[model samples]
Target chain A: MSQEPAVIDVPFEPHGLPPSVAGAAATTVSVSVTDLRNLRYDWVASAIPGRLLDAPLPIHSSFYETYHETPIKAANDVPRTIADALRGQLAAQGYRIGPDHADIRIGVIRFHEDIPSAQTMNNCFYNLIPETVSVVAIAAALVEVVDASDRPVFVKYYHAAHKVTPWCSPGQPIWAPSLLSLYRTNLIAAMRDMVGQIIGDSHFQEALAKGGRP
Target chain B: MKGAVIALAACALLTACGSIRFAVPYPSVGTPARTPGAANEIVNVVAKDDRTDPGGAVGRNGWQTLVPSNDPAGALAGGMRAELAARGYTVAPGHAQATLDLVSFAVDFLPNDLPLQASPGAPGGTVIATVGIIVIVRDPVARPVFAHYLQVHAAKPYYFNTSNAPDARTVLSEAMQSAITGMIADPAFQQAARRAQ
Candidate 1:
């Protein structure tokens, strides 16, 4: 007998506060931003940002790639695009952008959460649910940086050049701001001190010690 | 998903029950070549190097014994063979009309799998504090392909005998086999290859 899709409603309630800086004493740290690609997923075409179906690696692709010998500019451009986006968002929020003049540094980092399988995808689309099966959830974390000062400046950046759609055009887009709005919610959650602690502090050290980032 | 699983389980049960049968996904059979009107000769896959077999995945170390693809020829080449063969491609000894060369192979190791909750709350079952694996796959010849890395888990709460042989053997064979099967089944790869000269 075949089973029905379990419809396991994933709980994604708004977790915490959005990222923001309080004030002076160098409260901003424009961060290097990049995305964690979940290509291991089953229907990756839908999981990934459509704009980067053909973008280069490292900068816009996966950590499997590096900027060392790869000629493609998109390799390392991902971090730059992220830094620029965060700087712009911070500036718009009343924080100043500077090479080293900023206080309270903000770091935006994305890590892949899980992978999908073609079997699961086909099942989902066709309404087929297995009795018991495992599926990897496709996800990424967007971190917001805060200054160490008492004012506690909140530096924010909400776009990944890859998801900027048209702007994620690899080496072509040096600075793309297309993500300021769409990822605002996701980034805000990542920037929270409480949750960010998960990424900042040694919250999951046991796992980390067991394996390098997967 | 239920139907597929039920079908697969049924098939497995049938095998377990003594039905002596070999099957491949039907939708994937003879999907046709991409070259439009090319000679349609079988693509050749050559080993630029020597490939190793873990003697069927039973070894001294669970990680080491699992289908050894640590090297390019072993993992990368074997995967290409398996994936392609799964899709009904004949791997020739030498050059046919087209060829697969090991441009580059990369492996990623993840020490552990985090974001874990207490055992009772999640499905991971074990308190496996350390989890990681080596992803072995080939870089796309001309274009960037999706990740084909294999994930191997270690030191988890779940143990069925805890012998490296079964798990390592299962994973290694599955990874290599799937890689080749995937290559054959991918419509996108076929499209790109057809578009290429």
Candidate 2:
């Protein structure tokens, strides 16, 4: 049976803060970004929660291939876009973008779009027939607050996944350009939600306020 | 009429209870034609398959399945060499400018019996094929310029019918083809392959 689509609220209540810079905040924040996802495939598509089942190797008759090679710009371009968006979000929260030595440094740990088939399949088959696609965008980071001496004062990790949908109908194939476009659109929306979640959280706001200008 | 019924019942039993082995083709179509003398940089390609036979899956009536061949590492190395050669890079036996190694090749299926069903076919289940490669680009002096591990994954949905061998062949071929295409299409890969010796 298909369960209802999972609903997640943003800025999930922060767990009690740890000591050291526990109550610190900064006005200037620098962000370090990294892209670790496999850019070859359009997206992670799906990660079955448990162990995968083994099967036989049916593909026989080996042969060579010579095909035109096209660079995966879309996958390469996503990290830059997310970094730019985060900068804007941070600026709006009264944080200045600065060099690596800035008081607040946020390092992006992982960012990708996850489309779970089980969720999509359930959404389409159980809740409603003739279903559309379902996708979740993920953004995770490590936040480090340093004293003026560059000593680590406090550190916290944050990760968020948001469901965004244009729900491609069954008619829309996975490789269809339109589906990729929709996924990109949904990814942006999900990222925006995460930014809002982080900036609006009471704990983060307090951190920024401690040494913040505003 | 009664004979037809008995024959149909027997066929269903064979399909549902018996194991089926499918021979899927390696993806070689649509590869770009060899580029004319782009460069003389030599590249080495090596690969291997890591899936165990009668592998860890349980399908209907204990039906087990496989996707690639017993030795896909050999197949992938051959394919990679051909692809590099077509890109105008000279593939070599040793002391090359770059080496491409196939780290692993694997496939896992959901509802593992997508190609095994009773008389009529019903659509469900997905097959995911994953290929991992490591590219080491070296300068003329045998100095490593860059190295990176690249993995590609392809998934296809399938339906099983009384005669599933054909469907299995098609799906498995497509999955492998997609993976190969994905690997060579990497921007880093292009940059490395096109570098002058």
Interface RMSD of the candidates, in order: 19.4, 14.8
Off by over 4 Å in 1: A1-36, A39-214, B1-73, B82-162
Chain A of candidate 2 gets a TM-score of: 0.56
- Across B1-197, the per-residue lDDT of candidate 2 in tens digits comes to 22223333544554543455444455574757555444555666655333222232212211233433344556556666767777776777553454555433445455433222323445535555555555555555544444555555556765544444454455445655655555566666555555525
The TM-score measured for candidate 2 stands at 0.41
Q: Name the docking class for model 1.
A: incorrect
Which 10 successive residues of model 2 chain A have the least lDDT summed?
A: A60-69
Query: What global local distance difference test value does model 1 have?
Result: 0.29
Candidate No. with top TM-score:
2
Q: What is chain B's TM-score across the candidates, in the order shown?
A: 0.36, 0.62
lDDT of each: 0.29, 0.46
Tens-digit lDDT string for candidate 1 (A41-74): 2112212222121122212222112111111111
List the TM-score for candidate 2's chain B. Answer: 0.62
Candidate 1 chain A has its poorest 10 consecutive residues by lDDT at A64-73
